[model samples]
Target chain A: MELVKRLLSGDMRAAARLITHIENELPDAREAIRLIYPHTGKAHVIGVTGSPGSGKSTLVDSMITEFRKKDKTVGVICVDPSSPFTGGAILGDRIRMGNHFTDKDVFIRSLATRGALGGLSKATKDAIRILDALGKDVIIVETVGTGQDEVDIVKAAHTVLVLSVPGFGDEIQIMKAGILEIADILVVNKADRDGADKLALELTLMVDLGHEEKADQKWKPLVLKTVATKNIGTPELIETIERHLQYLKSSNLLEINHKKNIEREIIELVNEHLINHLLGIMKEGDFEKLIEKIVEREIDPYSATDEILKKLYSN
Target chain B: MSYERKIRILVAKPGLDGHDRGALVLCHAFRDAGMEVIYTGILQTPEQIVETALQEDVDVVALSLLNGAHMTLFPRVRQLLIERNAEDTIVCGGGIIPEHHKPELIRQGITGLYGPGTLLDVIINHVVERVKKERWKIA
Candidate 1:
C-alpha cells in the first residue's frame, strides 16, 4: 500500500517495480492493484499494433513527440515477443523511442509477450492501470508485432491504430477482415515506398466496404498515411487519435468503454482466482492424470470438469 | 513465487558511434540467451543510456562503441548510473579498447570489459551468473 501511495504520487521507480511484480504475477501484486483501483481510468489509453517491420515503434515515437508538444504527459508500454525456446526477449522498441529517454514526463517501459498468444503481454493491462494512476495524460500500449488475428488489443484500448506497410503481401492480404475490423484508424506507415498509395487506397476501400453495412456506426475509421521516420503526416495522425478520444468522450462511448473494461477486468480476476484456488487444492499431477483418464476413455471431459467443479464448490 | 525471471539489459552505443555491428550482434545473442534486451541504437548519450537503464529497470547496461570514446563514455555512463541511484545496474563494455586502459576502466567501476573476437557466450555467462547472484528484486 505504501508503494501504491508512492505510485499515486508519481514515483517512477515505484511504478516500474509494481509493473515487474505484476509481470511476474507476485501474490502482493493483487493487493497493490486493489489499492490502485480507485485511481484508475483517468488516462486515455491508445493501442498501436501492426505486423513486424511495419513501423509501429517509429510511428509511436512520432506520436510521443506530438503528445509531448501538447504538454501532455505520456506513458508507453511496448510489448515485444519472447522466444518460445528460451523465454528471453529483446525489447527493441525502445531503440526507436530513444529520443525520449531523458524526458522526465515520458515513461516508456518494454514488455515481452512471454508466450501470451496475443500481441500484448499479460502485464500490459495492469501496467496501463499503474501509469494511468501515475497521472499520465496519455498512455500508449504498443503490441508485439501482430498478424491479422491479434485483435485482443480492442479490449484493452480505447482506440486502436492498426498499421500496415507495402511489400507485406498482395491486395488480398490487405483486404482480409480480422484486424482491420477492429481499427479505429488504419495507418500506412513508411508511406514513401513505391506501393504506398495502393496500400492506403486498398485499406480505404476495405474500411469503406465495412462501413456500408454498419452505416449507423458512430465513428468511421480513418485511413492515414505517414512516413514516421521523416515526421511526415504524424501530426495529423496524432490529431486523428485525439479526435477519436474526443469522439469517445462527447458520445456516451467513453462510459460504455469504461463499463466494458471494468467488467472484463473483474471476470478475468475471477477466472484467475478460481484456477489458482482449484489448483492449490489438487495434488500435483492430478490434473494430468485426469487428462490421461480422458484420453484413455475411462472418463469423459465433461465429467472431469464436473469433478473439478465439485471439488471447487464442495468446500 | 518461483517464476523464472527475465534479466533485462540495455545494449547501447554512445558518443556518435555510427558503427553498431557489435551492439546489434549482442542484442541477438542476449535475446537468444533468454534475457530481455533493450537495444538503444547508435549515438546515445550517457544520460540517455542511464535514463533508459533506470526506466526499463534493466539489470545490465552493455555499451558497444567503435568511436574510440569508450574511456569518456564508459566512465560517464557509470557516473550517471551512480548519480541516478542505480549503482546496482552493472556496466559492461565491448569496443576497440587497448590493454593499458583496462585497469583504469575497472577502477572506474566498469566490469565485463571485452574487445573484438571475444566470444559472446563468455559475456552471456558473465551476465547470467552476475544477474542470478543478485536476483531478489521485488521478490
Candidate 2:
C-alpha cells in the first residue's frame, strides 16, 4: 500500500515495481492499479508499430533522446513476442537503448505479448495507465510488427508512426490496408540506403492516393525520412509528432479520440471482469445441472444461454 | 511432518538484452526437476525483478544477462532484494557471463555465477541443496 501511494506520487522505483507486479499477474497488483486508475490518462500515448528489422527500436531510442533534450519525461513499453513453450519473452530491444538506463526521467518496460493477438499484452493497457499516472510526459508503446493485429492494437495511441526501411522486399505487400489506414505519420528509416528515396516516393504516392479517397478530411499524412541508428532526421520526426499533436488538439479531434479510447478501455475491462466472475460461478457447480440438461437434450443451446443469462442477472 | 514444498524460482532477464534462449531452456529444466518456475519476460528493471520475486515468494532469484549490462544491473538487483528483506533468497546468475567477471559477481553477494556450458542439472542441484540447507537451518 505504501508503494502504491509512492507510485501515485510519481516515484519511479515504485512505478517500476508496480509494473513488475502487473506483468507477473499478481492478484494484489490489480487492486493496486484500481486504486491508482483515477490518477491516469494525462500522458500522450504514442504507438510505434513496424515490421521486425525495420529499425523501430533504434527509432524509439533516438526519439527518447530527443524528448529528453526537451526535458520531457518519457516512458517506453516495448512489446516482444513470447516463446509459447516457456512463456518467456526474448526482450532484446533494450540492447540498442542501453545508454538511457541511468536517466531517472526515462522508464522503459519490456513486455511479452503472451500469445495475445494485436501484438499487445493483455496487461499492456493497464501498464500504460500505470505509466501515465506516474506522470510521464510521453508514453511510447513500441510493438513488434506482426501484421494486422499489431496495427489494429496501436489505434489506441494519440499518434501512430508506422516505420519502414529501404530495400525491404515488396513494400507494397507489407503495407496492407490495415496498416496504411492507421499510420498518422509514415517514416522511411535507414534513409542513407540507396533505395530510401524510392521507398519514400512510393509512400508519398500512396498517402496522396489515400487522401483523395477521403476528400472530406483536411489533414494529410506526412512522410519523413530518417536513419534511426545514426540519429539523423529524428529531431524532425519528433517535431512532426508535436505538430500532429497540436493539430489534433486544435481540430478538437483529441477529445473525440480520447473519449473513444476511454469507452473502449471500459468496455474491455467490464467484459473481462464479467467473464472471470461468471467462470468463477460456473466452477462452483452452478452450471452443472444446466450442462446436464443440455447433454440430455432437455434444453437447446439457445435455451441454455437464456438460462445462464437469467441466473447471472438474478445474482 | 508437513511435506517440504518444492522450491519456487524466478528466473528473469533485466534490461534490454534480447538473448533469452538460455533463460527459457533453464526454466524448462527447472520445471522438469519439479520446481515451480516463474520467468519474467525480458527487459525488466532491477525493481521489477525484485518485486516479482517477492510476490512469487521464490526460494531463489536466478537471472540471465547476456547484454553486457550485468555489471550495472546485477548489483542493484542484489541490493533491492536485501532491502525487500529477501536476503535469504539465493541469487544466482548465468549466461555469457565472462570468466573474468565471476569473482566480482560473487564479491557483490551473488550466491553463484554460472556461465555458458554449465550443465542444467548442476545448477538445479546446487539451488536445491542450498535451499534445503537454508530451510533446515531455519527449522
Ten-residue segment with the worst summed lDDT in candidate 1 chain B?
Answer: B130-139
Calculate the i-RMS of every candidate, to one decimal place. Answer: 1.0, 8.1
User: Interface Cα RMSD for candidate 1?
Assistant: 1.0
Error of 2 at A303 (Å): 7.3
Q: What is the interface RMSD of candidate 2, in Å?
A: 8.1
Tens-digit lDDT track of model 1 for A1-315 = 788988999999889889988988888998998999889988999999999989999999999999999999999999999999999888889889988988999999999999887788888999999999999999999998899898879889999999999888887887777887889999999999999999888888888888898988889999999999989999998899999999999998999977987798789878978888898888899989999999999999999999888887887
Displacement of residue A170 (Cα, Å) in model 2 is 3.2
DockQ, candidate no. 2: 0.14
Q: Report per-candidate DockQ.
A: 0.77, 0.14
Q: Compared to the true structure, candidate 2 yields what TM-score?
A: 0.75
For model 2, what share of native contacts is present?
0.00
In Å, residue B114's CA in model 1 sits off its true spot by: 2.0
Summed backbone clashes in each candidate are 1, 3
DockQ, prediction 1: 0.77
Candidate 2 deviant stretches above 4 angstroms: A169-175, A283-315, B1-90, B94-108, B124-139
